[model samples]
Target: MSNSPQKYKTEINFSNDWDISTQDKYIFQFFHQQLEDLEANQLHVHGVKLYKVESSIVVTAILRHSLPKKLLLEQVVLLVKNKDGKELAKKQFDMALFGELEPCTARPWKFLFEEADLLVPLDEIENEMDFEMAFEYYEKVISDFELYLDENWSNGLTVDQQGYVKNLVSSLEPIKVNEISIVGFHFEESEQAVNIFIIIRNAFSQALTIENLPIQLFDATGDIVCKLGFPIGEFQIASKQARPISLSFSKEVFQKENPDFSSWKIEMVPQTL
Candidate 1:
């Protein structure tokens, strides 16, 4: 759903994190309530502030629910742009993953836009906060049956191959947010390395950067066939979305037994204590 906010006339607050003198409680207020003879279900945004930092701009805004009941959306995309219509950042949020938003209730939210996500330098930003915030709501409910693929993971898959994976996930159990699971998607053996394509599911609410994460491969009988530590960057699985990732190991690790991993079952392993 697109955002058709009825913008208010208040001046937006623009201040550095250390400078609070010029800051106001709210820079802009958006009223998306149902008007006369019209229907409106948009999520209202109010009391916004842009706090700029060295590497990121933190957006502090209030999110209000206008739906009849408590709204829990798992997929919502927010786009931020400058006054001149230059794009700043666009980020997706899992509303249900974070918490429930009650009807007509207002809550504060913060969106961090890193330097990599910004399209232009920070200096060009308007002091009066002359930018716009737009929200896009998606109806697709994320559940245990879905696997959101990282760009790197889906780049190599054919359209048919992707569809097969989607179908394959229906029979698999849901991976919880606190659990880290590495299930085999596909694998190939070579003279030097065995590249194992994996579907990594992480339900954690926040993204984490790590060095080595354990990946366990087990046979149908629940016996671990092999265990390996793979170096991973950031593992961020959306609320109910699993992601496909690839891990490669030296062929020597599997020299003892050549196993057909397609029929193997994946077991959940805790990320930490």
Candidate 2:
């Protein structure tokens, strides 16, 4: 009892959001000498406790890294399952929130699996329970912006460029889910014409094909600059996806009362039935 391995900082050991009462603790499983994951991370599940607050199941465990060198992990998926390997709860976590792990060091942390996060209802659980927790790193977590790009663009994007786009998308308003929207982010103005780079999003739950689309361009000051329409027989788009496009407005069509090209938008003009 004299020797216990060094633990990580105590600040990460508990959560302020979990108002778990000490008297409400119930059935739990104790795990030790568990298996090492592919990333050399080992999880020894000390136990799990149940509390009435939010039907939350808080697991107390010691996470250790067996590798010879220090590891810095971020946005890691923590998967929890029963002994039979049926997934019970899953959540993505940033390691920094838990604390540091030097080579071969272990840290104890309490993970709160709230009722809303549980795949299986709490009423279905028996008084006795056991759990296994592991990390899933390969699974991709799509961002709000990543859902906007179609397959072609997602496959060809560079990491840096993709990150840049993701940041830009975060600052913009959430994309409407029921209507089709055209968002223009860039414009290339030449003496001959103004080429607008646009992203068209289909928020409908099913695939859509718009054969003809009439649009009106408006500048930052809310003045109409041009009106154009497209015969888009080939512009078939999948449900809940977006595609990048370019629309050119020739000088003759673009009414330039010295129209500001720095910031502009295009709106889809309603068609008469």
Candidate 3:
């Protein structure tokens, strides 16, 4: 018979020490140990790729697992350093490696370091960049990776799917107002009705007048026990201020015989206007 070459590749065999319940935990621990070992040896530039886009730098790389077993990843921290051997910036990312990962698998990861993320100017990129050095040293840590620069690259901050870059902002900026919440609440029982006191805080700078606000009360079993609707009545709340409003409901409105007040929850129905 004529000799034939093998077409199928051999399956990877993992050692006994690599047994873990979830792939996320295993990958997290593996990367954590690798990073710790790199830091101990004063080499921090492995598994990282830097691309000098327009004014900002875009980093893209893959975190991989080579073991034969599937693993889970929870979170990982990336550190950026300057040419002076000084730490410049650090960011933590939540990994979505929840399910079982096949052997020799990889996950693509990207991070955008804007002007704010980088404390120093982009022109100052020098040979002392620790991330570059780390990548060179640990080239085998990741499989099939390459780095490229793009002058037309825009900031990845606006990308909603990339949650890691969403929080990258300046420290001096003020917190933006999104919505209002009930700060305090109380209830008083009278002979015929129950008084509901709701204290709301306006987080925005301008006055907010919500009309026909719907509030629902739920019992311990998550059943709607009572519903109340009232208008804010064109109330003007000053910038960064709080206001307390009171409403009353009939005692017969509650459907539960003996509702557990401690376990009850108040739900504010979302309104557009």
- Scored by CA lDDT, what does every candidate get? 0.59, 0.62, 0.49
Question: Of 1 and 3, which scores higher on TM-score?
Answer: 1
- Give the per-residue lDDT digits (tens) of candidate 3, residues 33-95: 444211111212233456677777776444445455565655555667654565554555554
Tens digits of per-residue lDDT for model 2 on 1-273? Answer: 656454422111222344545443221112223423323434333334333344866666556565566655665666777788888777766666665556665545676767776778776544436667777655432224333555666677787866665565555555556667777767788888888767776666788777777888988888999888867677777775656666788779877578876678888886620
Model 1 clash pairs are 177-203
- lDDT at residue 258 of model 1 (Cα atoms): 60
Please report the TM-score between candidate 1 and the true structure.
0.39
Arrange candidates, best TM-score first: 2, 1, 3
**TM-score to true structure, per model:** 0.39, 0.42, 0.36
Q: Candidate 3, clashing residue pairs?
A: 23-71, 23-72, 24-71, 24-72, 24-73, 45-134, 45-135, 46-134, 46-135
- In candidate 3, position 82 carries an lDDT of 55
TM-score, structure 2 vs. true: 0.42
Off by over 4 Å in 1: 1-146, 207-210, 219-225, 254-273
Worst 10 residues of 3 by lDDT: 138-147
